[model samples]
Target: MATTNQNGGNRRPRGGRIRAGSSRRAQSEQTELHLLRTATWLFSERGFHGTGIRDIADAAGVAVSAMYYYASSKDELLEAVMRRTLDVLVSSGEETLRDVADPAERLAAVIASHVAFHARNPRAAKVADHEFHALTGQVRQDILQQRDAYETVWSSILSAGVHDGTFKDRGTVARLALLQMTTGVAHWYRPHGELKIPQLCERFAEMGLALMGASREGRALEACDVNLPDTQLLLRRAELTIEPREKPTGL
Candidate 1:
């Protein structure tokens, strides 16, 4: 015998609620974001091997079953977090620097955007910087593609600068050094610290330009006409919402 509705029609158990339209998509995105936030904190704190699906679900205030709605497994959840960071970095970089032809200005914009992103999304940045070895096989490859996309923007900028005689051709060494310096900002920068995002970006932009030999043209920092998108505006443009938290609070 099957359960019957008030009208006397038999009703079958539904596996999941079917949500339609923009409201449904918005809700799904929200849930996925919540999961990413919870997982980022855990993965950063406990290391990937120490964190599990139950840990993520518990921290997120959702049941383990609900997690399956967003991701098939914890690995997938981690990958989503990684992808979100890369998406913001790559999309924001390309969008902001796309129209600029001068390599010095383009590189300044890249540094400003990169630093601001790391400052705004330190936890996610830290996780992406530190958690690569934990990801396996195809997942790692896919994430690296996103990573490469972002890196390629910098590479192109550097190569163009060299070709146009605006920067020194120290080869890949200079590029790697610049990236490492800018990306490492996430490790120690704090929202309450003396330098805010904009100022921090400016400082790093100056440093990056100097590293690339732009100082010779007296275009090290303020002289360079870098029209970087405002950090908050850039985040909105990228559709990335990163809620700032205290250092010890699990993301």
Candidate 2:
């Protein structure tokens, strides 16, 4: 059901006890993630235009008024879903800030982290990138900002690698194309249905690296065409290559 834009994750509290310093605002965000995940499933199944506030409230097991407290309209709920999706991708970046000193390894972590996160939460992933145009006003701008920020993560990583000798990309086109190829992973990933996240991530990372740095092993990965159980990745890449990038129907 995920188109190409939305991304996602479900946040569950840990150990039956809130963290020692978890603040009230943090708890509120957790509640919103719960509501957003529920709405994502409903929206993906019913389509955003087909869903209603009462439907989301019922699906989330919350009062309609409670849903209204966080999102006044369906558009606002859509924005919430986008923010939640971006939050996951950004969170994965934060994990490597200090631990990953090498640019190549850091970028590898970024790709692996992204593919893994999207594979874990397909509905939210789809809603964030695919269903976000259904927003209005400042909310739409805010979602765009989050999305641009996510892209910047890729842009910055490539730029950094280019500065050093660890990686190489000819231009922004090549850089973006490589990143989009990885993003395409989410559009077709299925854990139980076919390939595992690690397999997809590792394989795609190899291709991205090979395209950029021409890593010897990566080149082999690119040439290795063992058929996967599901032809999702090949099919997705083929569709993306042919499909024109359409302008969004902005709300």
> TM-scores, in order shown?
0.80, 0.66
Report the alpha-carbon TM-score of model 1 versus the true structure: 0.80
Candidate 2 lDDT tens digits, 118-217: 6665666666667776877776787688778877877787778777765666688966786677667667776576676657766776676666673333
Model 1: lDDT of residue 13: 26
Number of clashing residue pairs in every model?
Answer: 0, 12
lDDT by residue (82-117, candidate 1, tens digit) is 766676777777777777888888888888778877
| Runs with alpha carbons beyond 4 Å of true place in candidate 1 | 1-29, 215-232, 242-251
Can you list the residue pairs that collide in candidate 1? Answer: none
Error of 1 at 114 (Å): 0.4
lDDT of each: 0.73, 0.59
